[model samples]
Target: MRLATIHADEGTQAVGVDLSQDEPRFVRLRDEDLGSRPSMIDILSEPDGLHRAESAFNAGRAAGDFVEGRLAAPVPLPGKVLCIGLNYRDHAVETGAEIPSEPVCFVKFSSCVIGPGDPIVLPRVSSKVDFEAELVVVIGKRGKHISKESAFEHVAGYTIGHDVSARDWQKGRPGGQWTLGKNPDSFAPLGPYLVTPDEVGDPHALDVTLSLNGQTMQSGSTKEFIFGIDELIAHVSQLITLEPGDVIFTGTPPGVGDARTPPVYLQGGDHVEISIDDLGTLSNPVVAEPD
Candidate 1:
């Protein structure tokens, strides 16, 4: 099931998008109507929640009205967002960095997340902003010390994400935490919608890419991931309790602006779209901060 959260007449509501409709139909769901409570974290904690929600949603759909806009991020606010660095082999090579022995994790504060078609703010403190088109794994349940073998069972769904970075801040500050580089407001634009794990045949095979002002920057497949999905879940869960709505950014492939012959970074009017098959595309405009 492709699920989403969107702005409805009733306010921000969770929805089940019936892909069966020619254009997806948004079926409204109240927090109490969810299979589990509306905790984005717990709903994904088990695959069963998705199954139950589907059953409940179908019956409820008959009485509600349907809207025709695209899907928004499944979880508008996660308590936390865990991001992986150098998880893609080529991405490491492009940066001239060494591959890590284990998944190198960092984070973006929850305030960073935005829905597709949102605006990416360019702060005046940093002149070099770049885009990293990546596949984002949205957690289903709470887990710690979970084995990778059981990890997939814990995932609720998948979606596209843009790990928009501030290159100047990342490499510039001496030991300044990467969160500063990564955690700018709305730096992470997630979802057009969350396509449940069952619908995406194999998370490892989907092709992902980013286009900036009509030109492609990052283009690679999830297959290129050094640690893959299960490994990422198992690795991170060991250190922290991952809750529902928590997202794992699986790193981007080569071809970022930083690696260009002469760096071509985002400006006030540049628009970007990151897309992965089935998951949906995330597009945002780059805007200069007002003086």
Candidate 2:
């Protein structure tokens, strides 16, 4: 099943795919009528909530109302967003860093999130902005100290994500923490759609690619991940409680602009498009922050 959130009259409306036709059509989920799942977060937390909502949605004849161009981040206000760094072998190699035995985690503040087609603000404060395309894992249930064996059970689905970074702020800071480099508003552009685990099949084998200004820059697969999904989930869950709507950006592959000989960076009016197998392409235009 594919799910999405779209801007609507009252606010954002939760939507799901209706597979009854030749092409899957998106239908709105009337939360008021359904009486339980009010938001995407609520639906994700409940067991069998998707099934119940699907049945109710189909019976009400409310399918096919979705406007693909007006999508919001699938989980607009997720409780938190955990990001992994250097989790890919080639990515680690390009950065000239030793591969870590455990996942090197970071946080991309929720404020940085924007939806597909949204503009990624190129802050005037930093001139070295770079892009990293990654696969995001959206959590479905609450768990603490989750075992690696059962980690996949806690995943709601998958989505495409961009880890926009400011290299100067990230590496040149006094303390050298990445938070400042990664926390700019609209830095994390997610969605196009959130696809169900069943539809995505094996997360480990998808083709992940990213392009800037009509040129392919990063092209790789999840098969090169140094720390697999299960291990990363279990490792993070041990430190903090995983709740519904919590997103984790698994990591990005090689070909980051920072590693380029001339070090290319995002400028105003640049276009970035990222895609994963099954998960739709997420495209965003870059704009310089207003003076």
Candidate 3:
């Protein structure tokens, strides 16, 4: 089932689209046990909760009169948003980086998150803003010391993610880490909808492509990932506790602005669209920082 969280006047709420009826059906999940604040994150915490929500979504899609509209990201506020770098073989090659034995990880502040069609704000500090289209994994249940054998069981769903970066801040900075370069306002474009693990099947087999201002920039497949989801889970869990709604960016493919001959950084009013087979598409506009 495709689940999403739409931002309406009331607030962000869990919703599903009924393709058959062509309408929108909000999750009428009156969590009698948890009260009115039945947030997506809170619901995703329990393994059973995901199952129940999927069941509810299926039932609603069948029974309700569905309206056609855009779906937002399933998780509203993730506890932690961790990302992996250099996991894709072609991406690593294009960027002139070596393949790592272990997953290279990073963090993106939740504040960078924007809906699929939202505007991306290019920071004034860096003129070399680039885009990295990635597949984001949403955790189902909390787990620590998670084994690779059981890692897939802890996954809730998968969604398309655009890892917007400030190339200058990321490379030419004197910082100890890549935080400042990565975490700019409206840097991450997520959503369209979250497809359940069952629907997604093998995450590593999907086709991923990215376009900048309607020009095809990145075109690759998930098959080139150096470290798949299972390895990432086991490796990261060894150090920290993994919780529900914690998103993991499974790296990106080749063809970013920074990897070009002379480099082709994002200019004002650029549009980026990331498409992943089965999961759906994530599109957004890039706007320059206000003068």
Candidate 4:
């Protein structure tokens, strides 16, 4: 099942589960649960909520329960937006970086997250904004020191993510820390929908691609991940406690703009669309910061 968060009446939001026949269709969770507004985070954090919701969804949605609001980042207020760097073989190879024995991790502030169709603002301080299309993993259960053997058991599902970057701050900064370069406002655009694990078999088997202005830029597969999801979860859990609604951006494929012959940074009006098989497409338009 595909889940989404969409605008509702009077500055509110509602959880929507897709019950499409051909085109997209979403039934409001509140309409199913007696008007209680459940955020995507709320649904994920609950132990039995998703399953119960799925059962109710299968049972049926009333014709009046359908919604027509704009979608937001599925987990709009995720606890953390953790990301892995150099975890894709082709991506690492493109930058001439060595493959790591363990996952190289970083954090993108949750404040940087925006929903589908939102504008990706190129910061006024930087001219080298680049895009990294990544597959985001949404955690379903809380765990510490999670084992690789049971990591997937704690996964709620998968979604599409973009690790937008300011190349100058990322590489040429005073110190080489990645947070600042990656934490700019509107830097992380996620969603369209959150698909359950069962619906997305063998996460590593999916094809991932990114296109800039209708031209395919990055094309690869999760099979190329140097450190797979299981390893990433196990490794990160050893340090920080993983919780439901927390997300991990499992690196990007090769063909990033920064790796081009003459680096191709995003300019105002450029459109980026990243897609992963099973997961829906996430598209965002680039715009300069307001003067």
Candidate 5:
């Protein structure tokens, strides 16, 4: 079942999406429905939380009080927003980086997250902002030293992620400030929906694409991943613990702006859309940081 978080009169609410229809319908889940789980993170913390959510979704669908609320990041305040770099062979080749034997991990603080339809604020401090379309893995269960074989068991679902970057700070700086370059407000745009693993078969085989102002800028597939989800989870979990509502951006494909012929960076009024097959598209507008 597809799940989402949306702004309601009461506050942010966890919802289930009915995609069976042409236009998706949203069903607001009651607190009791999710066993008093107040947020998406709380729901996923329970082993059978998704199952309970699924049942709630089905019941709500039948009753038909479908909501029309503004969307919010599926997990608005993820405990951790881990990301992988150069995890795609083609992206690695494009950047002229050596294929690493293990996953190259990084962190994007939760403050960077914005939901679909939100604006990606082009910070005044950086002029070389670039886009990276990625497939995000939403962790369901908490575990450390997770095995690749059992990695899928800990996965709640998947979503699309836009890993916006500031090239000057990321690479042009004295010591390469990746964290500073990447953690700008609204730099991490996630969601439209958080689709369950059962609904998104073969996460490593989806088509990943990004378009800037209606022009396709990045196009590739998860099949090009150097370190797949299982490998990434197992690799990261060896040290840091993986918890519910923590998300891992599995990395972007080839055709990043930094590797382009002339380097196309984001500008004010530009629209960005990142689409991953089965996970749906995440679209955000580009805006300048206010004066």
Candidate 6:
């Protein structure tokens, strides 16, 4: 079952999505058990959250209609937003960076997150903002020192992620301010829905692509990943504890704007759309930060 967080009269509520019919239907998960105005994290953190959500979704009560501008990030305030860089062999080749034996990880704070239909504000300080399409893994269960063999046990599902970057701050600064370059407001656009693992078979076999305006800029497969999901989980858990709602952006493929001959950076009035095989498309418009 697919899940999402949406704005309602009661406030932000977690919802289960039904796509069986011609038009998609949404049912609010009876999360009264979770407390007032529970977020997606609160629901998924419960031991039988998904099961309860599934039961509620199948109850066939009045289905709620999606309100315009009501969809929010599935895990709006994730405790941690971990990102992997250069985990794709093709991506590394395009950037002319060496393939590392260990996973290259980074963090994007919650302040950077936004949902579908949101505008990606192009910061005035940076002139080389770029886009990356990535497949995000959402953790369902908490675990420390999770093994590669047991990694799937911790997975809740998957979602599409857009890792927006400001190349000038990311690499041109005094010492390369990765966090500053990456953590700008609305830099991480995630959601549409958080699809269950059962619905997204073999995450590593999916096709990922990103388009700017109407042209495809990046296209590649997870099959080119140098460090797969299981390995990434096992590698990171050895140090940091994995909690429910924590997400890992599994890196982007080649064809990044920075690698193009006359690098194509984002400008005002551009639309960015990212799509994965089973996961849905995450689209956002770009606007210049007001003076």
lDDT of each: 0.82, 0.87, 0.81, 0.87, 0.92, 0.89
Better candidate number, 2 or 5, judged by TM-score: 5
1-291: candidate 1 lDDT, tens digit per residue = 877887765456677777776767887554565643354444555457777667656765776646545445678888778899888888888889898889998889889988877889999899899889989898887789989899986687898888989988998888864879988898989988888877897899899989999888889988888998999999988889988778889989999999888987889999999889888778888899888
Which of the two candidates, 3 or 4, achieves a greater TM-score against the reference? Answer: 4
Model 4 bad stretches (over 4 Å) = 31-35, 59-64
Off by over 4 Å in 3: 21-37, 58-71, 175-177
- Across residues 1-291, which tens digit of lDDT does each residue of candidate 6 receive? 898888777677887777876966667665454556567897789998888777766663354434322678889888999999998899999899999989999999989999998999999999999999999999999999999999999999999999999999999999999999999999999988999999997999999999999899999999999998999999999999999999999999999999999999999999999999888889999999999
- Candidate 5 stretches with Cα past 4 Å from truth are 35-37
Question: How does candidate 6 score on lDDT?
Answer: 0.89
User: In angstroms, how far off is 95's CA in candidate 5?
Assistant: 0.7
lDDT of 2 by residue, 9-78 (tens): 6567677766567965567676565553367887887688677666756754454444343788989888
Writing each residue's lDDT as its tens digit, candidate 3 over 43-145 gives 6875587667756666655565233344556675678889999999988988788889899989999888888788999888888898899999999889999
Lowest-sum lDDT 10-residue window in model 6 = 60-69
* Better candidate by lDDT, 4 or 5: 5
Candidate 1 lDDT: 0.82
TM-score winner: 5
Worst 10 residues of 4 by lDDT: 10-19
What lDDT tens digits, residue by residue, belong to model 4 across residues 98-164?
8898899999999999999999999899999999999999999999999999999889999999999
The TM-score between candidate 5 and the true structure equals 0.98
Better of 5 and 6 by TM-score: 5
Deviation (Å) of 120 in candidate 5: 0.2
